[model samples]
Target: MTGGNWLGLSGKTIVVTGGSGGIGRAILRGALDAGARVVVLDYDAKTAEETAREADSAGCLAIGLGCDVSDTDSVAAAAEAVAERWGGCDVLINNAGILRPGPLEDLSLEDWTRMLDVNLNGCLIGSQIFGKQMVERGGGAIVHVASISASQPQPFSGAYSPGKAAVAMLSRQLAYEWGPKRIRSNVISPGLVLTPLSEAFYKDEDVRRARERLVPVGRIGRPQDMADVALFLASDRAAYVNGQEIVVDGGLSQTLMGTVPRPGYSG
Candidate 1:
């Protein structure tokens, strides 16, 4: 879509994990609209293929490859496929994650491990495998899709909070260790974004309004909000921006203390 002077991403190759839907899909669409070739790396073959077809139908260069982010072999194969097809990668968006919310005490060890495996470990795997390719090329960018849960704790979220918290630190570590190689690493923590997985919750008007109220912007976030940030971080515009976590929550996180008692304040 870009021909002259656009985000320095024209003709670049970007790989987005879990790109079949939700925020990942938005990122892929944003990249495609920015004239970048995108590869949808997802575990579900059907949805991945469907997404790829949709992109193609829209005149965007995109392909889908099934990948289980938690499995080493799966990630390696996906990287290899990208190497064979695109020669190498310019950006890697670690957006694949699983959230199994429940009380900590009631959550099983397996459940906790599963959450960490897909959320935290998956980031490491994708970064390591695809990062090596970037290191060989002497530079690249990685955008991890964490959540606001990483910073602010939420009750009944099992290990999701801990997993995302670890992902935040992991991105920083990658940024520090890989900066010398010119590879930039960053994090995008979204809050209250409606996706297929969470769309059902918004079915109730009261719940939707409640969520909007929590956000100081007076509305919930959209996938494009997070995607826009991801695109920025992936581009040269964010060359010096590394090891930083960008919260795309529409002023929600900043309102935590404000939600408390305000003796005489009644707006």
Candidate 2:
């Protein structure tokens, strides 16, 4: 009864990328709430410090780090700092990404490459950089914040979907390669969350309601929904879970709208 909790993540040190942004903030808060010492690594210095201040107020051991995860040198420096401070990495959440929405024909090659670099390459870099330590220190967990777009194709969202798809696969590959060393890797794919970045779509009452109607749960997802599951995947509760994608989409993926729309509407 005096041992670690069932989840086995209390007092663990967690490194989270993009922790200054919407979903990233949610994840940072959630991880802290779970009794983890969290490092909020982000590209923006001000926002990172703000996040650290807020988390500190909540009695969480947190540090705001400014680093470009897409840059290998920057990531290496950050990793070194973390290693020097945290003893050894226990958990890493690769949540840094960009959403450059455009049709394939209209998508800029630069933007496409950037998306792949951040969304896909960022996860890979973080995993490999921190993963080496995880392997050496016995083991750890890696969670990638992939999107529901990875599984369900999105219209007008070009590079984002493909990059996320690769993220899913990348997680699986890491799990396979690092399983022997005890490092676990998994992906959490979230759907339509009400984050600030998503305000544009939800700004219109009709649009928000229509999109909600599409979800089987009759509502869109919240960041906490994904973060709760993230808490598990990162913890020992999911010790057997690896190389898998847990879709947190409010049951929307299973429900197809084209087939059923009540008895009144028909083509």
Candidate 3:
């Protein structure tokens, strides 16, 4: 679908953090295709500008702004910019995050703090800043990009799962607290997705196939998979859906029982 405005997002303003690349970028494009003006927020200003330039086209407005979601001042400035340019944001997608792998036993305090700052605190900061705009506008949707690992802990990922878990709960808290204000908060927990950051791992054909077999859908997830769902959650069609965590893992999360050795139970 190419900016058909079927999602009813035409003229709506969308702010996406960490949208320079990966699933965030996919969501940015999806929002543009839905006919919404989008603002890309990334730590790297140059890359963000380049991405915005690439995604911009006729009938669609997209711009890039440098931001560190964990920094209140930075996000506040971005929010102010959005307000000045397009009045305020209609949809806020918190997709910026980082992963530092290390055993919990040996994880450094610095790494742990950094992960939480970006992965957990970042979401809260964005919601608070942009959420006010949504409140002033009467109502809006907030989509947080979490990870399936939020529920299922992944070893060697320093603070990643913990931070994500916190993010899920924080989203729910926001939903309950802000629901009466007409602001809806939701989370999207993605499974194993192949993004630019993880592209190197999938370069090995064997590695790719091995991972694909784990998902019941028989394929590794692409960025578009998450983007499709995000578009829905951000649209008015999902007005009734709030504070829910939509797991886009291709049924991979349900395979835990199948992982157990059931000799006679298996057909």
Best by lDDT: 3
lDDT of 1 at 124: 98
Cα-based lDDT for every prediction: 0.89, 0.86, 0.91
Q: What's each prediction's clash count? A: 0, 0, 1
Clashing residue pairs in candidate 3 (N, C-alpha, C atoms within 3 angstroms): 3-33
Return the lDDT, model 3, position 117. Answer: 97
Q: Report the C-alpha lDDT of model 2 over 57-82, residue by residue, as the tens digit.
A: 75348888888889999888888887
lDDT of 3 by residue, 147-232 (tens): 99999999999999999999999999999999999988999999999999999999999999999999999999999999989889
Error of 2 at 249 (Å): 0.5
TM-score of 1: 0.96
lDDT for 251 (candidate 3): 99
Candidate 3: Cα lDDT at 206: 97
Scored against the true structure, residue 107 in model 3 reaches a CA lDDT of: 99
Q: Compute each candidate's TM-score over C-alphas.
A: 0.96, 0.93, 0.96
Flag regions of model 3 displaced more than 4 Å: 1-4, 57-60, 265-267
Candidate closer to the true structure by lDDT (higher is better), 1 or 2: 1
lDDT of 1 by residue, 1-267 (tens): 232155888788899998987898888888887888899988897788789878777534798999999999999999998899888888999999887889987899999999999999999999999999898777999999999999889789899999999999999999999999899999999999999988999999999998898888899888989899999999988899999999999998898678677889755
